[model samples]
Target: MTSHHPAPRPARPVADLFSADGRLKAIPRKPARREALLAHLAATLFEDGRDYREPEVNEALLAVHEDFPALRRYLVIGGFLGRTKDGSTYRRQQQPGSPGGAIFAVA
Candidate 1:
């Protein structure tokens, strides 16, 4: 008798969204992939736990795309970056499933 298991989903590489110069090709449509892509972009462009001024954040994000405001909002909304109430500063937040947290194992 043969035992069968469903195939596992292939790992999606978010890097494909970037051009050769490292600019984002476009914002993803699917929420999950979009969050993942945003997280990756935040990690690449911003330093973890570092405080960045409003203009500094824009400068970094602008390197990826012309729509800096949307990208900044996505990064903040995705829980990748924490913004001050006055929006003067931004800092990278620890990702839920990242190195410091439990990834796939059961609780």
Candidate 2:
């Protein structure tokens, strides 16, 4: 018997998650969808090889949501963002070009 996995489709645009003025309507409730949304934020907001101070991180995140701390925590827990043990600096994690050229389906 053979087990076959379906090919991964491209990630959908998460624009709907945000309002016209570009603030999030709400953080997504489901984990997978949330991660995808965070990935979009991580990619767009942070630059590579640059470290952001906590204030800078907060300011950027606040532009997206008033609950910046929760968004920060979620981004860290989801591996979309990283920080030092002292929590003084934050940076976006480098994501690989879709491993196996696919994202595993999550429900």
| CA RMSD of each candidate after superposition | 7.4, 5.9
List ranges where model 1 is wrong by over 4 Å.
1-10, 97-107
TM for candidate 1 is 0.77
Q: Which candidate gets the maximum TM-score versus the true structure?
A: 2
TM-score, candidate number 2: 0.79
Error of 2 at 102 (Å): 16
- Please list all clashing residue pairs in model 1, or write none if there are none: none
lDDT of 2: 0.80
Q: Residues 19-56, candidate 1: write the lDDT tens digits.
A: 99988889877766777787787778888878999999
Give per-residue CA lDDT, model 2, range 1-107, as digits (tens). 23363545446779999999999999988766777788888898899789999999899999999999988987776667789999999988776345531244334
Each model's lDDT: 0.78, 0.80
